[model samples]
Target: MHQNPGGLSAAEIHTERKEQQRRRRNSLLLVVPILLFLFFAFVAPISSMLHRSIYNPTLVELIPDTINALSSWDRTGTPKPETLRTFSIELQQLAKQRESGRLASAVNRSYPGATSLINATARKLRNVDPNQLAQTGHLALLDTDPRWSETKLWQAIDRLGAKYRIDNYLTALDLERDAQGNIQKRQSSNIYIDLYSKTLSMSLIITLLCIALGYPVAYCLAHAPARIAGVLLVMVLLPFWTSFLVRTTAWIALLQTNGVINSVLQSVGIIHQPLELLYTPLATILAMTHILLPFMILPLYSVMKGIDPSHVKAALSLGSPPFSAFVRVYLPQTVPGLSAGSLLVFITAVGYYIIPALVGGTEGQMISNIIAYHMQQSNNWGLASALGSLLLAVIVILYWLYDRLVGASNLKLS
Candidate 1:
């Protein structure tokens, strides 16, 4: 046989190394598109939304001097002469840039006296020496209106300077700021805390109802023979095959005073007249429970199926009562499924804007409907986004708490 080369050819070795490096680089390159896509799609939009929530432009850009001058003064009382000096400087700069309108609009957003202030300052500047204008004209201008020296105006300017503040968060909760920068409950007309409370309460109620209704059904399905369980599962899933809107509408027709339920009741002499069933909390709860029952059932069924039947028998043989056995053995085992189902149903219920809007009366409306109204009807993206972010934060905190509790329980069990 021909003798092989003792050492590899230099070209062959170089080619092999290069091939290996190319493969490694290609593997790294594969992640680039995915990262780029995520940034462009999800991160970019969310960042844009966060930016929009705190965005108030003209105060920071146009009136920096005012913000700085007010920084030294206490917000609880009337502002000093320095605050007036700052305003004069801001107005002069605005006049030079011909952007007085923008400055007016900014001030107008919070407190009154924007257009008159801007106009008066522009006119006053014409009579004073340009260099001495801020120092001299500022004091004289304040004498014209004592409201100019009031702390409320300075406080309003200060609010814009902080950029990121709890103001929007407080506002969403129907709280307002006083002249002293303290938050208090809003007037009855403006108060929306009730809506938030109602939304949370309704979600909890619906979740409880789902658990109560779905537990037995799920237990039966879990214990049945495989063939029987499959048939029952198909029946449970049949509602999902139909459009949600169609199902809701069908319920509306069925539950209406002149419709199937009331007609059947009246015919059977169950009541003197058709009960007011269509536009009440009862209707909303019943409809939501019907729709969400499957969410609870599926999770519990999955967990119950995974559980060995011998555990319950062992508990009974140990002299535990039937209910006690269930509480000690079966119930503890179903914690994971219960948690999963409750979280799913609760989160889903909290965001139920369309269902509540369509079926619920004034007293039954949730926070989501108000947020939607702000977004679509009023075009108040700031308020809408603030509310949405608050809701998201609340959900995240709840989930984190749930995870911690579950982890602790698992650790203890192990």
Candidate 2:
């Protein structure tokens, strides 16, 4: 029973250390479920999105022979005779396997008419002799679909050879390659950049609106008596009890032309006709600001509550003017809450989908709406993933900037 420095027996000390280690292990085990959930729910999807945004192997895997053959051909126009021969041969094989539709879909994503052309030709070439397809590949392909002679279709086929490329990302940014292979702005369609700009602008507007609206409410709550503050806090959080869809649709009902607001305004003789409100950017901004206002207020109230009133009181008692004391003393102390609330509201607004989709019409559509369109409607998953990845990149950059500029340690929750 040898005793160590603190007069405890060696065995007791060992048992205490073992108990501490067991506690640490238990704590880690308790967090394991959350760590696993985050990995599966958040990390895995984002990792897949980042990967899929660039890597697409559908065409390369489907038509390996053609992809290999087209390796050396200059993409000025259609490929060489042998490359077309290889592609024609692969088309017959794919048609035999009933996988030509997949090829058509993959190609049609880059070049629209390829679906009709490829499917039709694959059907025509399905029964063609494989040996003859190998011999007169270009002729057979060209004969089946005269459109095969088109340079654009051939260029699209040439592009599929790169199993991993940023072509989708480039397209997401409203850019495409020229005939000479230099990336340039897409002349045919340029909607994404504008939508991205609108998204950021709308999010900023929502954040500012939240600050404007939330700051005063938070100040009141922080300064009020505990009994009154509890009632005020409940009022602030009352919105959370309502369904999100209900809240959003409530805005729709209020903003729509024959709705309560318009009817009330008309009754009050404010205007002859109902002002156009629904389906506009203003509708989205207002709804988002309202929905996110609580997020702003909570952080602000939390920070402002902890701040010592004496600091402002002392500044005032020292003969400082009220405005000057507030600006120089109290406002500086509230930076933590302001930064926390602004970042929270802005991030949430930036990624917001449901409210905007329901309230935001064409005029108010954000980048998220377009991303959803590409994913759900057009099924351009690659483009959607690229857009999402780019958005994620932007958000990460913004978050890093915020953290660098404002210091993440002071965000009220802590």
Candidate 3:
């Protein structure tokens, strides 16, 4: 064995390294469960959602032969008789599998009212033999349904037959691909952009309101005596104990036209008539601000509590005015807290679903509401996923901007 100047043998050094490696392996083993849980619970779902946004496999999976045949033909002219025969054969298989509805639904998403035409053709061809279908050409199929010759139907099929596409993302952005495979703005009323803008605007307003309301409360909590601060902290945390749904319902009851706020105002002779308060943008902003206020206060208070009062006092003793000392010396120290709290509140507000749904009327509904509508009501999971991905991208971009401008490293809880 080799010996070192410190009298450590090579074998002893090897054994020590092995021991360290063993400890590290054991430590890593302890965290494996957490890592697996995070991957399955968070990462897997997000990845699946993103994939769903771009994956369009229903048509290709059901009718591969038809799609393969159509791929060779120039899309400008009418589909040849051989292509029609191939599609008829595939339609027979699709009906045999009882998946005509699935294909029809998928096609209808691209071309409205296509489900009926496809279903009718499938029904007419259900019992026809494959040999008979081959013998009869495109003209016989056209006799069954004139739509068989229509370019729109074939184009819709070609559009829906892709295994993977960006149609969902384009639709989410209120855009579409033309027949020439060129991107174009949709002719329909564009609503997603409006909803997205509204979501961001409302979130910003709520963040500002939270900051305005939370800064003073946080200042008081941070500077108060121990007993007072403890009481104040409990008061701030009291909202957490209540359920979110319950709090939202309470706000609705208080903000309704004949609810507590209007009743109190009328009783005090402030207004002669009850004002409409429930189901408005004002109600949404107010409820969201209240719900998210504690988030802002807690972070601000944590950072402010650690600030040294002596620094501000020293500035005042140096003949600086109290307001100037505060603006110049003390305010700058709170930047970290402000950034942390504002980011927290803004992100949380952007994803809020329940409060807005309960209190927000037509004018106040947010993009999250639209996402939910597509997922649950319209049965448009692809569109929902695309919208969700877009929202996630926006958040990531905002975080990158915040990191660049405000320096995320400067953000602190305490």
Model 1 lDDT, residue 115, Cα: 63
Clashes (backbone N, CA, C under 3 Å), per candidate, total 0, 0, 0
Q: What are the TM-scores, per candidate, against the unseen true structure? A: 0.72, 0.91, 0.93
Q: Output the better candidate (1/3) by lDDT.
A: 3
Best-fitting candidate, scored by TM-score = 3
Clashing pairs in 3: none
How well is each residue in 1-414 modelled by candidate 3, as lDDT tens digits?
678998999889889999999999999999999999999998999999999999988888988988988898788667988999888888888888898988888899888888898899888888988898887746567878887787877887887888789999998889997787789999988889888999999999999999999999999999999999999999999899999888999999999989999999999999999999998889999999999999999989998998999999999999999999989888888888888999999999999998889899888889899899999998888999999999999998998899887884455422
lDDT of 2 by residue, 152-186 (tens): 88788888778899999998898988766789989
Root-mean-square deviation of each candidate, in angstroms? Answer: 6.1, 2.8, 2.4
Ranking by TM-score: 3, 2, 1
Error of 1 at 393 (Å): 1.7
Candidate 2 deviant stretches above 4 angstroms = 1-24, 408-414
* Candidate 3 error regions (>4 Å): 127-131, 408-414
Model 2 TM-score on a 0 to 1 scale: 0.91
For 97-143, candidate 1 gives per-residue lDDT tens digits of 78887766556555677667766666655455656756665676576
